[model samples]
Target chain A: MQVTVTTRTRSSSIAGYAAIALIVIGLALPAFASRSLIQDLFFILTMLTLAQLWNLIAGYGGMVSVGQQAFVGIGAYAMFAGVILWGMDPVPAILLGGVAGFLLAIPMAFFAFRLQGAYFAIGTWVIAEVTRLIIAQWKTLGGGTGTSLPREATSDIMGVEAIAQLFGLRDAAARDVLAYWLALLLAVGTMAAIYALLRSRTGLALAAVRDNDNAAQSVGVDARRVKWMVFLAAATMTGLVGALIYVQTARISPDAAFSVTTWTAYVIFIAVIGGIGRLEGPILGVLVFWGLQTAFSDYGSWYLLALGLIAIAVMLLAPRGLWGLIADRWGIALFPVQRRLILEGTRHG
Target chain B: MIWLDTVVQGVLLGGLYALFAAGLSLVFGIMRLVNLAHGDLIVASAFLILIVVETLGLNPFLAALVAAPALFALGWALQRFVLNRVLGKDILPPLLVTFGLSVALQNGMLELFSADSQRIAAGPLESASIDLGIVTVGTMPLLTFASAVLVIFLLNRLFYSTALGRAFRATSDDAVTASLMGINPKSVFAIATGLAMVIVTIAALYLGMRANFDPSVGPARLIYAFEAVIIGGLGSLWGTLIGGAIIGVAQTVGAQLNPEWQILAGHLAFLVVLILRPRGLFPRAVD
Candidate 1:
């Protein structure tokens, strides 16, 4: 008799093949897709990135933050500062945004970490608002009004010309293509990084801490360090996404940059609705969210109201999310992170 | 003399912030549920009062009397039906549910009110003021301050002196044990929320009178209330008032130094306080 441990399923392998095919098609999309379609894909990819980072912190790390916009805003600002102030290339400046997010997380964690549960959520929001207010006073960055990326920074960005030459596209189209490629890379990179992390030892520690901090601590999990690391990593990734988003838009404003509705609320909705704590959930969630937007956004506030109602209904009825439902019913996990032991012959030792 | 006037005015302004926090503090203290929709609910109550005022053409205060009970019923039903189900060990469900509620309420109000900032139009009461010996005070601010005090006092009375209050304390202390004593924690929670809604009505009345309110103003108001509750220490009613005053003074003082610093200064103070006292200034002794 033999026992075997595995994290893979037959469906998972099929899902992997499907994923490779999807990537192949995605890479070729620019050749056939309309500009608007490319742009919409960009939106979906960026949103999916944001949702994944948020899911990591809240779902696995047990820190429900309502102030993630703080990082997004800061990251966007940092990228702008990098290009405008230091004359750094726009692409390199985005990495700076991640660093800025990491730096900002220190003080944020300092204040927010003291509080527990719901207070932590509100505390983060307050800090974000405060950050917005302070940034609004900076006369250098267009103050409260915000500013656009300089033409030199946007048009003459590193690799724009090369990308244009390679794609045989004009300048504007080239920039869009470049941004689209970056978005694709970011989306894929973020998902792969998170998936890899979840399969690692630290990921197990994170789950343990999330389930019961005191108990995990008794088991020597170092819950504080785990939480700190998770917060920092999420902040850094969120910042990178934020910077990348604004780089594509080429404009920034404090209010727009720090918008809770866009950066935090929508991401939370995506993660929660799609099935939080699961790697595949945010992807499905973003698609559904985008679908809802396209189908019903013409109704304006009613659409938002509907989104809210759906979110509430999901939280109450299916706390595990839509994918959770499918997973439970079908026993399918495209990106299975949970470990399962199989008894080959069930022999007595 | 100017400094004295500013401090006094800030203290009066603190009363309004305290009013905003009272219901929030009460609900949080009893249930351990942070109602993300709390600020939106306050804004919604303001709208409810506006509808009553417009339809009946009654005085806003008189309208508040009508709005309060209606809001109380709304709160009761919300807690009994919606919130109570999500309550228990896992904190995420209530937080997310309330967040959804907040978004729905905001957009719903926006749809109904059309993003317009509306006021209660108190007729001379909006601008009327009385000269104290050292500083002049607006009639509305004074009334707001007095009402905040009265609300807190009544709440304290209810929380400490009544059988219902006893039930609240018992449930809050240990819901399982309290249930063994034949008390229905769900009803207690519903009643507590109803009481909180009444306070929210009071806060909404002054908010509409003293300032313009639109659907989107709820989250900001929630921030102010949260800061006050945290500064005062969780579950400490009187501490909330002092916390509100602290934020109020910080804002005013910052405004005096540089107008742009007003909101920033208040938040800085909150951070400083948080750094100094992680659990809040007056945290409850037990979890």
Candidate 2:
């Protein structure tokens, strides 16, 4: 019997429908869920978006960066500038975060791209620090201190009124709902973009580069261009998510905005433990992380200690991560993008 | 005279930065493992010294003597048990594991020590300065610089003139080949990390005495160490000293211009160095 290749699998199709159902439920979540629950989901969605961006760059692109907070802080600050300085609507300002990130990424990539392996990680971190220190000097944004969204800006934010009327909720709750919706839209859009990209020819090139750069070059994959593309795209999405995160908080400061521990380290923890190099990994990682945080957050440093231990254990025991372990055991591919061969004369299904 | 003083002060400050970067360079050169927890380990060392000083009523120097060996053991255990497993073809495991370690170390220090910044009381040395005709220097800064020089000198001797150093170099060149020649790569790595931790102990002593330190200060210290290492070249010890001096001078000069520009100036110098020499000012021949 001859073999035929296909990207689709029964499980993948099921996962696609499952994802659609999730989106629909997510859209209606604000209706029945409490304001706090909506707020919590906003955190999850934004964090999921951040984790996915990190997975794309580090996991798939093979560029490990510990300084993604650079984009996050810059994006947040840009959004703040858009709303506070230029009097733009918050919705459009969020998009400006992505633009600002993209703009900043050119110079950053030029500098950081010069280094390889571990140095690249530190190089990005140093740039992030410089960015934070420079941002702290802008007196218009409260300088070293920080500033919150103006009363008029937060009160009259776009879509808040409509959301309030539709849900019969108060202004504050409406703002939360609106931010939640934007976060949902952004997360869904990011996942879809990543999904579509991974299925394209460029995705094949990315996988090739990740597996082996020299071999990819030997095969004419243009590794450098692909890396630059992945880096810039990750930065833009991270910036957007960073902006949305601050929009929900309605305040911005250099420390809070550019915190490496909060913005970068935690994201790494999620992606690594959930599984790197898989679309399902970050989703699994975030839920586990969030669950761990909710359960043991009261213990303070012990919570972080446990996280460190778990990450190390997973790295040693199952470097492929939790989802990887499950996939290996059950032969499941929830979002299988890789091609596989089947005997043409046989009906495996 | 003012400019001379500024330059001299910057050099002394660079001594401290060099001390911080030395351990980092040693480990990276040997294993190619960038310890993300490095700055936190420095902070953790400071806490170890502090505990000895506070509880035993010993001076910081004596406390450091006690803390160094303890940290050596910790480093050795960490490398042998934790870091060695993650050191392989893929770079992500080491980076992620160390990143997690950084998080854990910082938070653990916070829980143990609280967030309050602490200083090691250096008695009369804290304010003592000596007058030179052109530039006056603080006694502490001078001692720190001397200690830094001594540490580098000793490290150089150990690396270049010792049998253990030979094993280190050989293992670093090719682990499998070194193993074939009767060296244990794992033990060599553990010893290298142990040695690095001793340097961290010295850096921690000055770091505590020089400024107020809390648990969260580790990452910032790490940045300075990283910048120095990059400016100097990744694997060169002497290069780290010069890089540290450059940063120290830039920061002092920037502070002279405007206080806010001090940190930014050091980073700018690093960036300029990076642009001019991507491999660093003194890149090793092998790389």
Candidate 3:
């Protein structure tokens, strides 16, 4: 008798094909989609990226940071500084956001990691608040009021001209297209990177650490290192998404950039409602979030109230989220990480 | 002389922060549940007091007394119905649920009250002050400090001298063993939360009178309370008071240097404390 270890299931294989098709459609979306549609897609993709990274740290790494806005806000500010201060193009400036996020994560992790469990969440939130207050002091960036990207910076972004000509659209619309493409690329890349990481040896260590830190440490997993790595990676990706978001708006305010409700709470809702600790969860969650926003956004605070209620209900009733419910019922895994032992050529011993 | 005045003001401010933190500290000590919605609950309690004062034409303090029992019921129901179910080994559910509740409460208040800042009108009492020779203090602040001390003192008495306090300690130490001894952990938790809400009502009275607040201010309040709790050390009530004072002093001193550094200074002090003493100044919990 022979046995094989495989992570893939029959359903997951089909999901792979479906995912490829979806990516194709997403890439071609700007070609035919209206400007508003592209803008909406941009919102979805960027949020999906944020949700995915958040899920990675909280869901997988067991570090539930409520201060992700720190990374996002810093990343956006870094990109703005890169363009306004350093004379860099906005496209290249996005990478600066990633760098800034990575740098901030070092000190943030150092401070926040001391506190365990729920206290950790509060620690991160404090750091984010400090970051916002400090950033508000930057007089060059319009101080507390915030500043907009120079008109030329927005119009002359690297790919905007090419995209404008290729799609036969105006600069503003073309900028949207460019930002949408970046967002789409980021979303896809994040999903792929997370999938690849989860399938790696380090990913196994991460899961082990999350399940039981003491037990995993007993089995020789460097839990601290794994957590730090996950935190840094998540922060970097979050920073990139933050920069991209501000670039799309072309306006950066300390309040808006570092908003807990917009950056952290909403991302958490998407991750939790779609499902935590699952890669496919954020994808589905972002879609659901976008749908809710489109339908109920006009109601103002009531919309937020509804979102909060829904999140609470989901946490209470469906702790595993919508995807968890579906997966349990159907035994389907679009992004299966469970290793199954398959027995082949069974013979009488 | 100027520094002494700033320090004095900071101590008084710390009393407000301690009021904000005492309920949080109590709930955490009893159940090991970090109520993320705590700040919003304080805000909500304030709004409730405001409504009571406006409708009944009562003093703010009297309105808080009227509002306290109702808040106690709300907190009791909240724990008995919502939070109790999520309390367990995995910290994710309680954290997420409370966070959701916080958002919901904030938005609900926003929907009802609008974004405009509102304050509880205290008439001349709001502006009345007392001379201390060296440094004068506002009557409201002086009262707030006295209330904070009284609340902590009473809470200590409730914790050490009462049967319910024994149950809280037992449950907090080991829920399973406490349950084996015929204590209903769930009911105990509900009562603890109810008590916490009573403290919150007191905090709310001072908070509403101290400054104008909108729905958005709840998170900042939560941060201040959290900082106090962390600075004091987990499960230590006196530690929480000291922690609050530290933050208050930091903010006042920072503001003296530069107005913009006020909140930032408090947070920086927290971070510095965390770095120097990760276990906090008076950590009681072994874990």
Candidate 4:
């Protein structure tokens, strides 16, 4: 009980400091950071959000979904409708896009959740494709051509041209700035939410479920419910990221919105390499991944092949992930969720 | 009458969908590894066949035969070397590994083949059609549908009647137990993946024969196969046929109603089925 009290106090203090830091940084990012840096950060933030959300489901909840792109697409299209059709402001519309994803997920989860394990993973992909086809068929959205945001909505928050000149990015400036900052905030928010969830009782339940579903169920944990809840949460958050992605690019083609390659390929790679089921792994992973992309992206298509090889090597050599290895090696936990329960000797008891 | 034609064509088209899904179902049924590379492998096979046909001036169908054995070997090697290491109590490793592999394969193919779309030119067979009493059906599609049915039919026989099926099912049921019986679980998995590759080769035959394909087409094919597998039920071969038919009918009929409705129609059908029967049309495998 004493330990619990100490931990709680410590956690609250950390949360407080983190919140303050974030608020300060959030406000300052637009002003302090160059547009190019902001843009790069935004893209990283988007990946962070996705990795965190995926980490929650696959890492904590034991659902290794390959279909997070489904929610991403749903969110994008919803935003498209809100902005292009209803003329809603992009920010609020983006939130609504998340709700739209949530709604879509309700029906999606029903189909996917029926099967456990691999079926669940495949079910999510199938669901995403279904959404894609449905969206693609809706002709007004540009059909196979895919839809782009109306020019007014995105053509230019895009102070990149002005900012890019500062950093020597002649043309890609506005794009770099808008995309970068947006990605950064979203990623931070996702990580914060996931960290919070892991610390909460619900997070414990999810971890329990991941460790052993039967055991979790025996302990009065509704394993299925936890899975569903997290699934929905992950979907909603990911879908929202999808919105920000297209908003930055000013495009929402079914192919782009539902592109599995974007998330499934590298998000999984990042999380796996950073370490699955471990907090801070994805952060490390995203850093490493982007670093590799920057260094090796010139390999063009072979870059994917190399990434695949690296991921496989990492999975075999370090299944615990890079962060997992660090933690295991040093007994460190940056975002530790485990409780410190004290036990007395049986004889003393 | 036109609607009748559409319905018939959809049923026939369902056969192709079934073939696309059969190997996927087989792999999942045995070991719950959702091969993200499954569809891409099909595209890879098509490319292989295209190369063979284009270079050798052989019939596309004949080239498929040559490619099948090679794909099976490729699948065998991949499983024996790469995949076997990843199968585990933890599912994410395999999924991620495969996801990475899928990306690698796509980009690898792109680098080697470039992004230009290629079709396996089939000469007169490409244009051939059979006039049924109600409507005319393309000979190639009808053949594709028939091949799908035939593949499923044979697979069903193998699963129920053959010793190999027993090995596959037993391994799927309890890999540890199967090992105790002296069955090499790893070999079983390798064979299963190889067998799936063979099925993929068949799917490739039609995919190449029917339309133009590029390196990027694999993931989309994977989606179709995945949907069919789920809609049909995870492990049921025949159910995959029905699932494919549902998707096919929805797409064609939706297109019939409004040319723009084709894609939407397919997605709506999948969504509707998912909502109504989340367990799918036939669920033979369990988590």
Best first by lDDT, ranked = 3, 1, 2, 4
Tens digit per residue, CA lDDT, model 3, B128-221: 9999999999999999988988999998898889999899888888899999999999999999999999999999999999899888898898
lDDT of 1 by residue, B200-250 (tens): 999999999999999999988888898999899878889899898999988
**Which pairs clash in the backbone of model 2?**
none
Which digits, one per residue and each the tens of the lDDT, describe model 1 over residues A12-53? 999989999998899988887777888899999999999999
Provide the TM-score for each candidate, comma-separated: 0.97, 0.98, 0.98, 0.88
Q: Ten-residue segment with the worst summed lDDT in candidate 1 chain B?
A: B278-287
Residue A189 deviation, candidate 2, in Å?
1.2
Candidate 3 regions exceeding 4 Å error are A346-349
Residues B1-287 of candidate 4: C-alpha lDDT, one tens digit per residue = 98998888778777777788899989888888888888888998988998899899898888888888899999999899988999988777787778878888898999999999888888899999999777999999999998998899999898989988999888888899999998898999999999999999999999888889999998877767777887888678899989999988887898899887776677678767877777788788765
lDDT of 2 by residue, B65-140 (tens): 9988889999999999999999987888988889888888888888988999999889999999998777789999
lDDT of 4 by residue, A76-111 (tens): 888888888887766567787689878988987777
What stretches of model 4 exceed 4 Å from their correct place?
A: A1-33, A137-143, A147-182, A341-349, B271-287
* Chain A accuracy as TM-score for every candidate: 0.96, 0.97, 0.98, 0.86
DockQ of 3: 0.84
Model 4 gets an lDDT of 0.81
Interface RMSD of each: 0.9, 1.1, 0.9, 2.0
Cα error, candidate 3, residue A348 (Å): 20
Question: Candidate 4, DockQ to 2 decimals?
Answer: 0.60
Task: List per-model TM-scores for chain B.
Answer: 0.98, 0.98, 0.99, 0.96
Better candidate number, 2 or 4, judged by lDDT: 2
Top-scoring candidate (lDDT): 3
